[model samples]
Target: MQDKQLNKDEIAQLTEADWKQRLTSDEYHVMREKGTERPFTGVYNDIDDKGVYRCKGCGASLFNSDNKFDAGCGWPSFDQGVDNAAIDEHVDDSLGMRRTEVTCSNCGAHLGHVFPDGPRETTGMRYCINSVSIDLDKNEH
Candidate 1:
């Protein structure tokens, strides 16, 4: 099922406490605190199912199953988001490394990092996402 995207007003109205209550501890850590789940430990790491992955924090559609691919990176990798508007990217200088951080466009929740070393056949971008940061809605068709 496709989720309704939340407006900025709705996203801004949600306090930290509300977010804490809405998301699990792990989800909160990864999505709200910009934490990364251990490699190979994420639920979606090896999933090849057909679905749309949405932000766990706000349920915003972020990635389509068609874009997902196994990069052997121990995380759920995708070539791109559902669209350009579904995610926001920023320069991350944390952990002594520079990376492009991907976030939910609606709520500014961290999703993961994107790398340039992806399949050359596709967009050449690898969206290395944390499983706790997203929920997948399996396509029934």
Candidate 2:
């Protein structure tokens, strides 16, 4: 979590070797390769910690624990995000399945998918996210 993406000028100034030194293996894979971690397999999958979940790639606040829900799916699911601007939704037809892919708006890093099957009283939106793609900020108060 200590390692954050710098501005364009800062990152642009760094060589390939420098970038490698600044990032962890997982961060490099998810951020640079746009790959996904296995479902129900992330460290935060079972986390009961209280905090805001931010995009690991850009440190943008994405979700709050209060909004998280049990989707019975392998990944972490949320009924709501911090705000509309915190995430972006795109139409994804990859893998022959039509779905909306959600990404971190701040850095355009893929977090996971969105489904219309959410609580009826809620937004009817399910943000299925990858745990490794996020970093939690525990509240001290």
lDDT of each: 0.89, 0.77
TM-score for all models, in order of appearance = 0.93, 0.82
Model 2 residue 12 CA deviation in Å: 7.8
Off by over 4 Å in 1: 1-5
| Residue runs of model 2 more than 4 Å from their true location after superposition | 2-22
Which candidate has the top score in lDDT? 1
| Candidate 1 lDDT tens digits, 14-125 | 9999989988899889989999999999989998888889888777889998899999988999999988999999999999999999999988999999999998998999
lDDT of 1: 0.89
Model 2, span 50-134: residue lDDT tens: 8989877656788998878777887888998899888989998988989998987766667888999977788888898888788
After superposition of all CA atoms, the RMSD between model 1 and the true structure is 1.9
